[model samples]
Structures are given as structure tokens and as C-alpha cells.
Target: MKRTQARFDVVGQLGALRRYARSLTRDSSDAEDLVQDALLRACENRSSFEAGREVRPWLLSILHNVFVDKTRRSKSESLRIKGLAEMSPKQLDAPQDHSVRLAQIRAAFMKLPEEQRTALHLVTIEGLSYQEAADTLAIPVGTLMSRISRGREALRSFEQGRDQTSLKLVGGRDVS
Candidate 1:
């Protein structure tokens, strides 16, 4: 009965645990899993308690460490898997759509210099503010704005090319 009481006391912070976990992982399934793993570790290490301290933050610290350790392990395993020479050309010859407009847009974006691509992706795709994106990327705000401008111009050029090709296919009459 005492063990059950201890479990209840330790588990009472589950909601807070989940909230913090969600913030860290950004996915509900992964957050729930992280919370469960943290709780299990907390339970196992209950004897390490210093007797008069709040347990929530202590448990959360353990949870964060567990997540970091797990992420490192996963990355290490992925690196190992990538090292195997599976360089078969058959994989490269798979027939896929080369004419999809979105694919073309992605290809054009890939052709941009790296800085412009990063700025565009962070601002447009990730929806970060110019300032936030700049900070995240460790670039000056002016540089971020310049990169965004260049990226947008490149995209416009690509889109115009697609529109011209499409119009040629249907008969080159500019409807405007």
C-alpha cells in the first residue's frame, strides 16, 4: 500500500509531464511515449530522492536526458545504416513524375545557392518571421531580407517558365 501511495505521488504530475514533453518533441505520440519512459525511470530511481525536494522538475530533467540519449542512439544507428554501400543504379532509374509543377518548383529551389534556399525554406515553408528566421539561422536581418528577395525572384522565374510551357502545350495565346 505504501508503494502504491508513492506511485500516486510520483504520477500526479503526469499532465505537466506531458505538456513539457510535447513542447520538446512537438508530436503527440512521441510526447506520450517520452512521458511514459520518464515515469518509468522516475519510478526506478525513486530511492535517489533527497527527501524534501519537489520531484516534478527532477523527473523532467531525467526525461530530457532520456530523450537526448535516445535521439543520439537513433542518429548513430542511421549513420551506420547509411554507411553500407547500397549504391545500385537500379534505385536511381525508378520512373517518377518529372513534370509535376510542384516537383519543378522544388527542383528550381534546389538550384538556388544554399543561403537563399535556407532563408526561403525557413520563412516560407517553416513560416518563421524574418527576424525569427534570421536569429535561428544566425544571420543578420538585412542578409535574411536579401536572401528572401532573391529566393522569391527565382521562384517567380521558375513559375513563369512553367506557365509558358503550359501555354505552349494548349496554344500560345496569352489570355490576358
Candidate 2:
């Protein structure tokens, strides 16, 4: 395919890519940066793209790779910032009850392991089929299912104020 056509095809999927990025980063500025980085990488490596394959998944795979790389690089910086923020004074400000609950859920969701979180987001939020999400993540369908299951269980445990071990040991047997 010609360069112009390939760029056009990629641009067509930009909205979906941005949405996926936003889901991954949870910050608009960071998500936009991620999308831009992914697009730049995709354009630079366009030769690797197969002409007959779908573009959205390819773009998504690139976005995921970019996110992983950024996350690895920023791990220490993030920790430092988090530690500094924790050392600061606390505010007594309170949000609305509904907003507070939503914030709690979002915080719990963010606390999930990265793999499980990605799997759940792709399947549930992105409305991707199991096979499609598996393809995007480059994992087996069973592995993807396992991630989603674990992610859901973890979120449930967070809401219920229970640990995963306790949840699995109900009725004098491991239910997991």
C-alpha cells in the first residue's frame, strides 16, 4: 500500500485508538500523548503492516506496546510523585455520595494487575469479543478468560472488603 493510503487508514481508526488509550491511561493528556506516540511508531514501521489485515487491531497492538514502554520508563517517577503527594497535608473536602462511590470503584479498578485490567477493559469497555481481545493482546483465549475472571473477582473483593484467599475458601473448600 502507498504511504498516503496507509496513513489515511490509520487516521480512520484514530477515535477508537484514543478511546482505548484513555481507558488505559485514565488521563486525557496522557492518553493523547500515548495515541500520538503509537501513531508515530506505526507510521515509522508501516512496512511491517500487512496490506490485507485490519488496521484497528494493528493500531491497538501498537498502542498497547507504547503504553507498556511508557509505564516501564515512568515507574520510578510515578513512585516519587506518589510518595511526595502522600507526605503533603490532607484535605477534609468531601464529594457527593454517588461520586464518592464511583471514585472508590474507579480506584479499585485502577488497583487491579495490569494484565487483568487490560483484559477486562478490552472485553467489557471496548466491546471486543474474546477472540478479538485475545488477538489484540497476543494471548490464548483461555489466558484472556482467566485474566478477565481474576480481574472481576478482584474488583468484587475490593467492593466486599474481602481478600481473594477468603473468597476462595468459602464453605470449607476452595471455590476458585
Task: Supply the TM-score for candidate 1.
Answer: 0.45
C-alpha positional error of residue 140 in candidate 2 after TM-score superposition, expressed in Å: 90
Which candidate comes out best when scored by lDDT? 2
Task: Give a tens-digit lDDT track for model 2, residues 48-108.
Answer: 8876778889999999999999998799789999999999878754668779889888877
Q: Where in model 2 is the C-alpha error above 4 Å?
A: 1-8, 76-176
Deviation (Å) of 57 in candidate 2: 0.4
| Segments in model 1 whose C-alpha atoms lie over 4 Å from true places | 1-8, 85-176
Worst 10 residues of 1 by lDDT: 163-172
RMSD of each: 20.5, 25.8
Q: List the residue pairs that clash in candidate 2.
A: none
Q: Rate the local accuracy (lDDT) of all candidates.
A: 0.78, 0.86
